[model samples]
Target: MFNNSIPTFKFLSYRRLQAGSLCPMGCNEDEYLHHISNSCSKIKDVFGHLNNWGFAIISCHSFADRCSWLEKKSSFIINLFCSTIYLSWKNRCEMVFGKTGKSPLSITTEAIGIASSLVICNHQNSGQLVVNQQDLLYKSWHPPPPDWIKFNVDASLLCSYKGGVGGVCHDHRGRLLLAFGRSCVHWDIAHLELLAIKTINEVFKDWMLEYNGIIIEGDNINIIKLIHKKIKAGMEGMEYLSFTKNFNHVICNWVNRDSNKLADLCANYAILSSFD
Candidate 1:
């Protein structure tokens, strides 16, 4: 009854059956969902506090049963269930492999954050910006335009004798918002591109404004591909994978080096000015 795309679920089910007998905190197929959701005494303290926020941990005999339960619930309830399930799974992984045991409050807080983000993302994707009636009212009071404002970013690496990286971001009106340069002990174009993306993310966080969308422009085609394409195994792709995962909320694009002149100039200035 399972789909092939969710191979992990199949693996988990097989592992559960082999263990034989389910104890809330021990290996058992019967305990697969229950132990993680409600029966685990280790996380009971955390679950206790979630009731006030209208979160309840329910038990189901199988994944199918869980799906049925979700189908009958309201959207808010469904979101809460998904959030708790994700956090519980995360906690289980951390306990077994990560060797880090977090407090219940921490887990609850994380679950809430994940739930909120999921709701926001789903709404955004459906072209429905408002989560509730209140959100609609709030937007009505201060309406943002339907069109998205785009920002283009680029990083340049100069390799003649001295090694350094330059990064700049500009608004739609061609106004420079961020520009900087830094010396690199080793001249690596890929590394510089990653550094520039990281810097841009930091700047966006500090801006404290909700943007409808963002488009990151870079000259490095490989870096763009790395961010957009799926990575194979090994450390060669890990940094780029991590960076893309971390900033997937923002859209990224690739542009010709010649088309990104203003940002290039800004980066060049930052590097040259640092020496003087």
Candidate 2:
């Protein structure tokens, strides 16, 4: 999956590519975050709301400069900034993947809603207000068994039926082995979660990963229980049978959504992405 020939990595040295200084969008110019946020005909609309929020979207010379500005902002404003950027990224993915025609205004609305919810949650957790103990959950990601790599997955629907799923694999010491997010047009979460597992399994296989075990974790208790039973009974479906047959140490477990935050974040990322 590591394509060294192009700028596949997020921090890739992209200037050396064959396309050189031209965007794939045919702008005949380098595709930097500045161009993406301001000049790209495909995604310029995605940043329109930034002007309404008093942010000079095109003023930042680089992504790091924007980060520096965001770092000085309040939580509410930071949420808005980060969420808008994330939504814009997702829209870019959609355009690249040829799933276009979505309205920028609608996406802006969703980004605002998500940012407001995050602000509210931050306020509740900030301890300035009394949050009910019964309603508050402080679940944190836990390490897997000593030698296992845990894969946590989550899926959510946004913008009415567009789905995204994401998963991450971390070793016992919390070292990330892999992470992926994918977007789909359907809102069938049950299907999406399972698809995430299958994709993860394939990646592990392709990488020829050396691990004592692979633990699949997610928030769906029923699916967790079912997978566990299938593995135990040696009756795992075709989707997972290859995994069970190849690896003697595989596990399926349920985690609270809070504990699976990384995976959930991946899923959120996926909903706006077009790739694994």
Candidate 3:
């Protein structure tokens, strides 16, 4: 992208490919790397939120201009900026090439989440003790209480908006009892996360009878809150709450994405395998 070699519609049209130069975002402007990454009205809110988070993104004319502007920023800022750009472009592709339409708010929220994970990882890799409560929460996975089973569930969403849910059940000793992953259809990550919990409920119906007390862990705090009754779960989310009736005692908790790596891998495998 920095070298201005990305195959934007303007570039493809200029090269005599059967493509239109007008922006796919309906901006009536040429579709180019810089325009898509910045200055597009459809994505203005995304950069606006980043600026509010102290990650200032300056609109530039060319890819080289963007590179020059980023040269003065810190490594962390550059990494986050690059990630946001990539996500914005990928979201655009999902709209133009796939059957997904994600809102700018969702994209901005996802970008911020990715940026937070980068911050946490950087602190850990630098051998610096993360003193922030949020950072500490993302440090590692904790084992369940004595005699209680723990289930870690996660949902993965591809750029095409294809999704998958996966989860694993482990005893108090951290011994894995069951693991499952399956492809799902959802345009929103939040819905997919809820689907993941529902899948765990269905998959472990028999285990719920055996294990009286269980804890469910997922990285999406909002979904955890929904399950806790702290937030509204609409009619659809209400359906996922059926697990509470099956288990004698169940705890749905939020864990760090880093700690949920195995579940994430399972989810990703489910989505990727469907393409094969």
Candidate 4:
């Protein structure tokens, strides 16, 4: 990108891959790397929010200026900058190909997630863990298949069995559609995880008509296995059946804790916020 090698619409048109130099994002302007970094409102919104996230990013008006600005930044910042740029371009391609394009907010979240995962991989390679690294890795959450809506759920418990259960629903593009967290007075971790899975329908009941496939992912492999093995033949079975009946496909999968961080964050937040 710094070498201006990215095949923007202008370049593609020059190479006869496109009909004209108009922006693929429909901004009605010639597409250029510089335009993406400087004038594109969508990418601009992403950077604006990223600055609020404490990256302290600066605005550079030209591709050369961007390169110069990145030269003085820390490696982490440079990686984040490059990641954001790449994601912005990917979103553009999705739109151009008639796929649902991500909003600026979703793009910003994805950039941060990618950067966070890279940072985690770096730390793991260095044989050191950052404080609360598990929490920081929540940004690594993955999206489901293009036709699915995924619910990631988790449970956090204290010694007294007082804790919280939380879950979040995201569409295939990783846009959060619904999030739910609830404080519980007394529940073991296993039951709590089960409850989190069981309540997914209640949280997403209204949106059932809007989505076709349902995927429930959690970090507790044992609990996930239990769910797959057998559901209780009572209210629990009915609830599960009703939710499944609404979707063409219902999938339950176990993810590693790192990939389930957002749900963990939500659960922990629920426990912490209950006292307030």
Cα miss at 143, model 3 (Å)?
A: 13
Of candidate 4, the 10-residue stretch with the lowest lDDT total is: 130-139
For each of the candidates, the C-alpha root-mean-square deviation to the true structure, in angstroms, is: 17.3, 11.4, 13.0, 9.4
Residues 139-212, model 2: lDDT tens digits: 45556777777788888777588888777776665545566777887767788777766666555644434667
Clashes of 3: 0
Worst 10 residues of 3 by lDDT: 130-139
Error of 3 at 222 (Å): 22
C-alpha RMSD in Å of predicted model 2 compared with the true structure: 11.4
For each candidate, the alpha-carbon lDDT, in order, equals 0.51, 0.62, 0.71, 0.74
Query: Where is model 4 more than 4 Å wrong at Cα?
Result: 128-276
Question: Which of the predicted structures, 1 or 3, would earn the higher lDDT when compared with the native?
Answer: 3
lDDT of 1 by residue, 46-140 (tens): 56645633456565665677678778775645666667656766676666565776666556655554554455455556976644422321232
Per-model TM values vs. the true structure: 0.37, 0.51, 0.49, 0.51
lDDT of 4 at 39: 76
Alpha-carbon error at 206 in model 1, in Å?
A: 13
Clashes of each: 1, 1, 0, 0
**Which pairs in model 2 have colliding backbones?**
164-271
